[model samples]
Target chain A: MNNTLKKNDMKTAYIMLLPIVGLLTVFVVIPLLYAIFVSFYQWSFYQDSIFVGFSNYLLVLKDQAFYKAMWTGIKFALIVIPIQFVAAFLFAHLIKNLTAKVGGFVKTSIYIPHVISGVVASIVFMFIYNYNGGLANYIVSLFGSEPIPFLADVKYALGSISLPAIWLGFGFTTLIILAGINDIPDSYYEAAEIDGANTFHKMIFITLPLLKNVFLYVIVVGLTGAIQQFDLAYVMTNGGPLNSTMTPNLFIYTHFKNDPYMGYTISAALLLFVIIGVISALMFRLINSKQVED
Target chain B: MKKPKFLAFMLTVLFIISSILTGCSGTGPAGTEEEKPDDSSDSGKTVLNFWTPQWGDADKEWWEKNIEAYNKSQDKVEVKLEIVPGDAWDQKVVAAQAAGTSPDITTMNYNKIIFSAEQGKILPLDEYTDPAIWDDLYENIAEFVTLDGKHYAYPMLAEPSAVLFYRKDMFKEAGLDPEKAPVTWDELIEYGKKLKKGNVFGLAAAGNAAEYGWTHWGFQAMVGQQPISEDWSEATIVNEPTKELITFWNEMYQSGILPKQPLGGYTDIKPLAEGQVAMQINGSWAIGQLRNDYPDLLDNIGVAVVPTNDGNQDKPTASLGGWTLTIDGNSKHPKESAEFIQWLLAGDEQIMVDFFKDVTKFSKFTARKSVDEVLAQDSEGANDPWRKLIAEEVVPYAVAEPIYAWEVSMAYATALERVMLEGTDLEKSLQTAEKEINDYIKNNNYAGTNPKK
Candidate 1:
């Protein structure tokens, strides 16, 4: 009788899973496979795409501008990720420790930027960074320093642009970290306190270790988001002041959006996709393995 | 119980499938009788989709008024003007075209019109328009819209390239005469030096490559010296004159008369409008903005022709910047669109021109020669300096940029950006660009291929 019930349960489970599996196959798997297929062809909007094998890959590899854009993307992600993570983590930690009402207010304030549209944020940033009479320059003047050309200089353009991205991202990331911290039990901290662990020690040994999963999650997600950055760069710089801020995504978009060179853009996009996939997979493995050992 | 659950799920799936099949099988709104209006000739009933790039608030208001007037004037077509913001306009238009769901009439820049026409996306108006209509437009303006002996668009307006605009009040405050505007390159440099101060800049030239940078200002200013050969073949004209312009601009950058290293010109227009700049070399459109947005600065502001190498230069050659309205080839209402275009272009629609004119307050030269006198009469006023400039100086000296296939021109512009911003070796950059462009042309089979293919 027990064996018969078990068999019946197994059959019901498989039936329930069938529709979901079919949907994934139709939507995600098929489109991804088709994109991969198209990436190998020499695509043009006006004519038939010819089979080009790995020539598109070769072309992208040989292109100097593409490499420059890739490097820029890496630098942008590197700069923005750490700043965003630490700031967000601290804010979240502070909010978690605050009175409920105060914490809610702080959370609301920080999350406002996350809600603002990227284009709107970029325009506002432009005004603040304007060369003359801009808020940034006005503040610089108070310090008796010369105004910096935030958007126009190659030296400062990338950093200046990353400011808005970081500002826009910090709020959401803080909320995520705050949620993760709140999920930790009070009993662990109480035990540490009873054992005479100092506040700093409790945080370092217990809080940080317990929040590792959340930190890893933020890092990986943040890196992927930064790598695919487009709207901020397009709105603020359009890859200007010597293309100092040009990212691979912007390059792909410009080609596809302005002139429809579908084949080249698709190839570039596929390359980026592969890079993102490999990096993300490696990150996931490293984080998961560390978690397992811990 | 399990069977009933399965049956319910299957029924839901069947319903969804049947709905999708029905959706696919059903005739589109375009083909269905239900799509047609019950009263086709009903007053204030027809819907016309009009697309334009975002202009500032004043310009938007003006356009709204003009469109409203047109709708009011016509009993049939009620035009709906949709203003796409600058950042998304290009992408939106491209997507619309790809989806085969573009608006009936849309505005496109001269460079884009050629490419779109070549792709057979836009209708050629030559068949729909009378040849006599062509004779009325400024000769160069007419030539710009014509490709392969076909008219692809109606000339909307032509904005002359950069000219020196100065603050008369600021000049006086700086103890310089306003009437004697800078006439020679050397004089301009000196004037800029004189105007430089703790807060104010002498001249504002767009330095950011993203905003078309110094190329639009410096390159076009040197147009008289470097005319593209009658046949648009090579950059043979990038000779001594081009080099001189580059050297002069670089020297200006170094002189401390202009803004410091990593100069800000492109994205920030407020600096000039707010009187932070004593002088600015900008497009004719700036005049309209100064009039509308900076009404307080009216008495202080003055316009002047750009300085040349010597007084011998006949007139300032400004870069021709404008848009042309074209009907989509795939449009369902070509007849209506063509008629609407004709009505828009008629001399009586000077109000429309006035409304659509940029900050510079310059209207496009009318295609009909008969309207020239009327345009002059309409524009005659002390308050309307931009109108005068457009009618007199800009219309004559304006020249169109060389047209290439879409990809080639974009590649060329990209190359130009690199050369200007990175200070790349000009000859090498041009060589590489020329090679890349030619290769693209050959691959794409763009028009004006050299050596007879």
Candidate 2:
């Protein structure tokens, strides 16, 4: 009877899993495989496909634009992840202690940017970063400096593109971190306080250590999200002044439009996929390996 | 670990996320704002899925109203309309074709449609369209869509790539001739210097790569139109006249009369309309924008052809660009699409005339000579001085936009951008552009693939 019950439970679980697994196979697995197949051939939007083997992959790996875009994406993630981490942590901690009414109001206000579409946020940032006759330039002028070409110049393009992304993503990260903080038991903090711990000491010892899994989730998600940014950067810079702001997704997207570049573009996309996968794995390994070190 | 605290944290997190998600709904300027295409044909009539690039508000409304009217007028075919955002239109169309869900009919530029024609992805309209319809179109505009004696698309209208729009007040203030716009590259610089003042730029043109990429075709026409060779064999952008043209622009760029950073794109006349700059090199459509938005400033605005390479006014400083109707290769109802194209653009002169009117007072020139004749007699057509000026002085001298791949144009644009903005070597920039184009050509085996053949 126990064996039969176990078998029934197994059958039920498998039935429950079928829909999602079927969906994953259909939507994700098939497309990925198809993309891989297309990457191996000199396929085009309108022309006949010519089997080119792995020449496309080899060519994309050597292409300077591919490297430039990858580096830009990495740089973008690096800039966004650290700043988002610190800001979200700080805001979450501060907001966690406030009275319910005030905390709710602040939380809601902080989260507004998360709801704003990337397109709208990018547009808003574009106005703010306008080279002349803009709010940023106005502030600079007050300091007696020339108006900085925020979106226009290569020097400031990447950072300028990152600002909107940071603003848009800031609220979600803060909220998630706050939830993680809230999940910690008050008893730990109480015991730390009894052991001569102040708020700062308790926070340092009790909060950060316990929130390791949350930190991993946020970092891995945020890094990958920032690296794949397309709409925000495309809206603000269209990968220009120079391509200083071209993320991996934008680079792949631009290549996909130009005809006869289908094979080459797909190869680049797969390379980007690999890059993202590797980054995610490295993040998981780095974070999980920490284990609070007892 | 406490459920109560976890619940409280979740509430806070959810509230916070509400504000953070403000970036979710809006689309980028060039990003997808897709309206659902018709999935299945209605009742019994044939369904034609028609896609049009994003147009001005008035034009968009006109398209919607007309397509609805067209559908209502006929029971044999039903036209379903989808307006694709201009920036994403090309990629979406190509991708749709690749996926075998291509639209039955769509708006295409004559230059761009040629490549699709060569690929056997576009149907030759001549097979289904009457020859009389072809004869009604202006010879110059019609010639672009007709390749190897086959008409691939139907011409709607054409506009010059660049027209010199200046503030007459600025010219008067600077003691320059407001009546006679600059006719030569040298004169442009001289006039620009006189107009320069504190907090105001002397001139504004396409200052960045993408805008310059589009506007450069006109500039290429100014020198001579061999940006590539006649036989499509090699890049000819480094020739002497073109070299001189780039240097002249670079010299003007370096002369400090123009703003270091442009206030807007090449097609935007907002800088001129708002009085941010004294002179703007914008398309002829600026007349409509100025007429519609800044009428008070219209009297102060002067419209002129962009300066020729030499002092000759007959030389084109701009290229003609306009949309045409094309039937998809995979279209199930080619004959119906051809009939629809004919009924809308070619059959009725008044319909095309109304289209010109809806687009704001003939800011765009008509492609059909019959439509042109009708407009030439109407109040806003021949009577509108700006229209008259553009039609006679600008349109006559303009060359058709080149039909090469956008990548070739972008390479040249980037090269010119690096040279003009960063003061890089002209020789190096040209060499880089040439190499990039050659590589693209060689990889694609581009020889004898010309649609004109």
Which CAPRI quality tier does the interface of model 1 achieve?
A: acceptable
Task: Give the C-alpha miss distance for residue B259 in model 2, angstroms.
Answer: 3.4
lDDT of 2 by residue, B119-168 (tens): 76788988788889999888989888877788999988898878899999
Q: Which regions in candidate 2 have their CA more than 4 angstroms from the true location?
A: A1-8, A44-48, A186-206, A290-294, B1-43, B72-74, B225-227, B239-242, B254-256
* Leading candidate by TM-score: 2
TM-score per candidate, in order?
A: 0.82, 0.89
Please give the lDDT score at residue B172 for candidate 2. Answer: 90
Please name the candidate that would achieve the greatest DockQ relative to the true structure.
1
So what's the TM-score on candidate 2? 0.89
Overlapping backbone residue pairs in candidate 2 total 22
